[model samples]
Target: MYLVKIIKLALVSGAIFIGVHAFAQDDNNKAVVMGNFQLDGQYYLEDSAISAVVPEETMALSGFGNILYRKGKFTAGMRFETYLPAPVGYPAGASWSGTGIGYRFAQYSDDLFDITVGNFYEQFGNGMIMRTWEDRGLGVDYMLDGVRLKVRPSDWSEITAIYGKQRFNFDNGTQFVSDDLGQGIVRGINADFDLNSLLDSIVALPGQLSIGGSFVSKFQNNNSARYDFPENVGAGSARLKYNIGGFQFSGEYTWIGENPSAQNAQIVNIPDSLDPSVGLWATGKGVNLNGTYSTRGFGVSITASSLSNMAFQSQREAGAFDSWINYLPPTSVLQTYLLSQLYPYATQPNGEVAYRGDLFYNFKRNTTLGGRYGMKLELSYTQVNSPNIAELNDLGTSRNGAKIDLFDPGDEIYFSDFNAKLTKKFSKKFKGILFYQNIVYNNDVILGAYDYDNVPTKGTVYSDLFVFEGNVKINKKNNIRFEAQALFTNQHLQDWVAGLVEYTVSPHWFFTVIDQWNYGNGDGDDFHFPSVSWGYIKNSSRISVTYGRQRAGVFCVGGICRVVPASNGLSISITSSF
Candidate 1:
């Protein structure tokens, strides 16, 4: 029986870690147990395309360790992890090897009131709707396993409550029913206020204001009632923030319920028996979606900012990572390196909506066009859709219309980006930057049309990039930095060229070199990726080494993406802290 349920869950997690370390050593007041610890390990040096899809390439290791404790006001923690043969894109049914004690908690607070139980991580307000957090190299975790409460009843009110069960990967054993086995619950509550002290007693206002609201619910149990689902799945949110001084503004709105996702299913091909009369067609048994969305923000003064319709997720697989949610109110604009790689978009927990904005300005130190200078400009936009379906027909005649195509629904993923930059300082060993970028991509909804190794063309994709970055200072320990990029795509892989160089010898050591060239692909072997690295940082400990040629795309973290295969050599990393 699975080794007696793993030895009774390791004897109930070692008697709850020895009864919370013997009640913190019988409370003996000598308080001061701060905490800090870290360890990271990696080693790999064998490649047959990563050992023929990781059939075991001689060496692989993963580790995590944490132990925190604070005295007065009480606080406790635990985290320990190990993955003997876990690497090469991790998650392949996980559990390559295991070790327990993955986050245990206890907390208490003063100055008002607060409490927490087993595991906890929470977020409301601009979290768009809800959030639960944890991010382990993007493996992502939705930590929530019970009690939590908070209260503050004075200087502007505060309240919260939560109850739960969520944390899926890591051994995959507690889904707590519901697949029709009944018993599945999740609940939440929230409040925050200080609406500028009720709008300054109903009058004078120039800034400062806050308001919040939240309510979340989920309970599962269904006998598949001919498909009516929604055994309670609720959502509600409202928030507003305003400030005046360097400017700031915020907004939020959310609603959810009708849940029924699996991308809304729409598979049909039934006929093992049951035949009505050869003219019997009745497809569309899934997809009944609707989950409202709204997010807004505005800013000025220190430049400008604007945002709208931010999408958020608490589970339903919470985008896999990009970093633990709790809220991710920024819709687009993350862009970094490689033609702004597409990333963790996975939150469609049943529906979606999105929006984003940004702006910054600084220039007025030396004249002649601020030539001692600085300049920056940015723009972003995003859109997503697929909800609201119900259209079935066949026998009763409706012209063969059979809705519910949700899975991959009405396709339309969006993106738009613009950037401009210029910075210069000629003294202190020179410094420079000049950048330009323009991007628009849809690419059949961000790749995944089987990643087009089978060519068809035009699903919307455009790119333009130009960059020149530099830094040089030969004194005080030596330094050098440089980068150049140029990419202009025509469709898929039509143009790309990149370069980087780095050298730093400060408190420790550093060295790096990189190259990427795809130079218009008509299949002339235009793909080449190169890399080299060396690092050693003392004072807390750090180590790094690399030799490479890696390229295989798709490695999203947070919308959960994985599909990396293409390797070519030595790598090592070690980190330590105490």
Candidate 2:
């Protein structure tokens, strides 16, 4: 009822504007219009064996369309979203199952200033202090619903400010208030400066230098009486970057004020007793550093970070990816292979130190190591550990959390992984990649309660994963690919093996089938998870239908994660843009 009117209005205005300007003699009368849409629907079937059942609703649909209009310095866009009985395990609760104008924004800009109202998304340097963005795949659409302003005062300086409310997601579809606009009102300011552009004569070098800073604060009324939490939580971050030809380095440091809520309990469990006033939310701080070097076919990067009580959420009681005020950059490798992602690491925001290093090189052709074609090698290693923690005793009335040394090594470890890959092309139509990985995963911390009862040792999981991918082009119009993956472990879930085969016909259609088997679970309850998908593509439009048994696993982004439930169903998706 509401978004329909806006759509009609937009269509009418677009038609009028185009009719009056497209034929105008003026060269600037180039009215621009573009739109994109996506539809995802699923038909749930009851299969007690795989735990896939939809009692109340047999099917579900989720779709959205974004229409944008731009004419010279003026721009406007609107997003329409609808969800009918949202899919299972889609963290965003059921209250979002209605058609509405999810996002709308209009902006006018020139050489000096840009302004937007209604809705927008923005991020500060490295997104350490504040970032308002969206990830449809993760059900994270926390875009800001307010006004944003940006200005370039000089050639070397830029400033941005925003006052908005986050997009609140109902934890589930059934019971939630219509607080779709978010629960907290947040305000933030960010600025960046380039020293080289401001003063070139003083530092006349072949490199570049830049610095940026951000300050963000979110205000939400506190209702808890047990703990006196701050209604206004403020976080600030500063970042610096410099590059000289082949070498580059960047870092960001952030400080956050104290605020306690659900994840960071007001009462914490220590050695023997519970400290009511001490939790992970007691005045936190974090720092992230990264360095990179590249030469010819050789490139490498190293990233390190320390997080101490750095969990910042708009609503202290929110769960999953809801009402997030700020994001913490993760230091783990984003695995692409199937087996590598089986026990992927998620960032620990409370107190942890993490680091990752990666190197890539391509050997020259006709060499001893390289055959007719060159061979490519990639190596990556990542590790994360708990921060050094010690008690802090102030006045009897003023009890805070423990003090954490950012760089000091702690005894407890969260996760660690080391992986390497080698890729080579034998001929014009064939290529393959071989990979190996070793991972030390702490299921206690990552899987939380889901794995606590499942793990027998109540300890860490030592596992190894191997993967091989080969692809071939069977002519100008046909292509084929295959994948073989295996994971070996002595802990929970034990060993798993997976295989995939895919065939694609150029410019149109593709089919794929994959099967994953948990063959060494120690328990005789081994299972098989298989799926098949067919996809078609035409221009900017594409559609795919998949019928499969989905395995339950932890999906993560940055340092945050959401659990996907196991189900067996038919899913269809279509996307188009014009």
Candidate 3:
């Protein structure tokens, strides 16, 4: 049955692409078709040691395909997706089952104007005010389903406008509905100017400079029973970028009108009379700044941001990454190693101040301290904290209402990390890397834990991690890589050690073996997580398989995160583009 469904989807998608050729009106402007496909399936098994839960169906699968057509200045595309009760850790579940068209769009573009109707993704200046995008790996697809228009007045200036509804979910009800996307309608407009280009046309200018501004608003019906909800909410942002030689600086400030919703709601002490006048209502604001300088083999960068009640969403009641109208940019490094990802950070939108800094230097080759093949060193530090806010004292129970200062960094630290990496090529065929990291994680805030009395149940956890990795080219056709990692901590799950070995055969196949050991648990109990995987790649297509015991942890991509449950499963993945 699964195989039949897969083949059926492929055929349907192919037919859709092939049928587009009939729309080619001119022989000289024939249509060009392109697309890509991916499938991930997993079979679950019961594992008592790790408390792995087996799905009722024992297996799950999800897949998607996008087909695009282009001819002259006209373009169109459609994406079909299916989730057969997605895997255990996937964001989709029974609610997203079955198959249907997830996205479809038609666009026309020329030198001065561009327009798109149906579904599209867009962003405005650092995405502080508006951003519609997708990260399939994270199951985050917030494409707007409506109309978008772009007008370029000149080479140095442009304006954009959009009216749409953010895609929320694929509800395969009796009618197979995917539209009427969210509870609210979103509308936005933006204008951008290139100062350097505009001035250079009249007179020469140094370096480059650009400025942009955006305004986004959402409207929803006021049908609340108890609280007097605001029917319309608006947000705006201004941003600028300047570059001179090896130095660059960029910044943005965003502000939003009162928007009371579940994600950022706070209780207020009001009259006992059942009146709809008082409820969770508050405005929001955000600020982001960055500066960088680089020259030769050295580079340095610093970034800082502050957010207060910035959980902007279309649906007032939506939660957990749903109906988001804006995104808080990430400020931390992306960790790829298995254990390093166990404690990944997720951006806090409620109220926080974050900072990140990076320094990189490359040592010259064939010098006294540079060695034979040169060396590269990278250092990074990131920290996040609660915003400095004055209390309103309206809650009575405690000071709940907040008066935030966007520039002040608070005393309560949420998370901090310092990491360094040194890489070198000792020989023509060998390369090695040494990495170290120290993290201070506030579990009470980041991981979230509270007792029945609303008291904190977890404290801060400090950990030190070390990793060493090496790659060796055995010959022109064979290569080997290995990694050894260790983590020491006194809190949470205690200490861990892990190792990985991978072998690659030229052009086609690869195999991997990995294991993580919880050898220093505070309870004196030991556990082992082992996994094996293999893959084959050819051209643009690849297939991989794995059988493994996965530890429960947060999986993150660019600071956005989702919980992945513990599991023992056999998984298969296939991807191809054409």
Candidate 4:
């Protein structure tokens, strides 16, 4: 393992030195130097409600930037990151406060092939089963640290392969378990090909056809343990797409191996008896399965995915960073408004099955009703279930005489929503949209599960929201947009009303103000949350400042979620490019 690390370092260092020295001598290299940087600094005003995490009236600064040089077939780049006084809400005991070259890599590409060393991002198909990427705002990044290759032998097909270890943050450190082993390794291969091209030479077929497949495997060394654990884990997926005239269809399916992590485990209900096999046995309450199955598409998708005792991660020993091996499909509808997201569904890492469908069409551009008005609609539904479990009991006067009990499996955890919207253009500068949304959410199953303090009670929340939005043109250099919404609901909180106004000055500046008020609460205490923000954009640089009172809620992307605390203060953000 040490030798492999040495070799990798030597290769990257040599490549960087050679690439830079060679490019310096080429007069017509045509290489362009470019990249961007961003800095975020915040000063918190004293607020007792939000001061538990950070001191009152304190300030913190954190920033990151990158530099890249691209010439004809070669490219090299590096990124620098710093956290002088790491911002609030960072993970407890996190020590990522320093300035260093966090990411460095070099790449070479041409008509036939492309290669990269040090760091890169890749995805297989829809990334339902395998994806390695980054989302900065969410603090999620899992870039591979090694070598990647891409090949194109023909015009109709391409292939890619990669081998590496996942990066956590700024440094490379080993995870120390009770029985220390070596680092883990991951490798994957994928290919995309056009079926029409192949059939054009062999047979006659109409329309366009495309298909792709990918396979990924991870290796981990296991030490002595009472239970059996597989050293090698593998997953694969396949996809197909067909388009002919006005009709189009696409589908994907993925299968994963049994790789249990922290997310999937069985819960034990212990009694007064000291016997190891006695007491009530309970399966983990959340999503738990044997392996994993996922199928999704644009036309119609019916997915029955079960994750038995499977906690997919790139490094079995590393902390949660860029280590997820499988993507957890979301089983709840995503709400767009700040108030509507009060009880958001966090993905159950243990198990779930979901089905979704979407349809869209356009009317003629010049008819009495269809000419100026464009009609659009959307509908989505999801369902969730718990894992199956078997109970065991053995503590008694006769040790050999033991009893086993199995509990009945639960029903689908949740179900929701149908939404629709219509838009019309009064003229080029004036446009309006009428929107309606209906959602039936199961609060007891999702939120109750997270906030265990509350007892589990079954109830459905139904909401009807009507919104009218439009944009107006004052002149070629100025425009303004307005929105007004009313929500009617009987469960949870009372009915609410909201509004927003935005003004933009062409070429560089814009400002927006929004407010939401719970007007029909029976308790007579109506809460109000409001904010105003201004942004300046030029080329690849942007700056934004916002001051407001924010309500707390769960923020999520994909299936990952984080709870954002309520804050009342001013925030500033700056981004620039060279």
- Flag clash pairs in model 4: 142-322, 287-350, 287-351, 288-350, 289-307, 289-308, 289-309, 290-308, 314-323, 367-371
Report the candidate with higher TM-score, 1 versus 3.
Answer: 3
Lowest lDDT sum, 10 consecutive residues, model 3, at 173-182
TM-score of decoy 3: 0.90
* 507-564 per-residue lDDT for model 3 (tens digits): 9999999999878864334368889999999999999999998777776653356666
Which 10 consecutive residues of model 4 have the lowest summed lDDT?
284-293
Best by lDDT: 3
Q: Estimate, for each residue in 1-578, the C-alpha lDDT of model 1 and write its tens digit.
A: 99999999999999977876776676663345443434344444544422323335445666666777776688888777665655665655324345566677888987788898988888877554568766565455667778888888766778889887655556413232234333435678989998777567678777687878888776655444233445665777776677665445555655555443222221111212122222222211111111222223222222111212122223322233321323533244455665445222333432334443444445554666556644333333444444344544465532332233333334454445566666666567878777777766554554421222433245766678888888899899989988888888776666778788989999899999987777576653536667898999998777888777665555664444455555556567666656
Worst 10 residues of 2 by lDDT: 172-181
Clashes of 3: 0
Error (Å) of candidate 1 at residue 415 is 14
lDDT of 2 by residue, 47-113 (tens): 6554554637788888888999977788899987777866776774424566777778999888899
Tens digits of lDDT, candidate 4, 179-259 = 232245678999999988877789766878899998888877754243245567787778877766545566666665765
**Would you give me the overall lDDT of model 3?**
0.81
The list of candidate 4 runs beyond 4 A from truth reads: 1-28, 46-57, 84-96, 170-184, 266-311, 317-322, 329-349, 371-410, 427-429, 448-460, 490-493, 519-526
Between candidates 2 and 3, the one scoring higher on lDDT is: 3
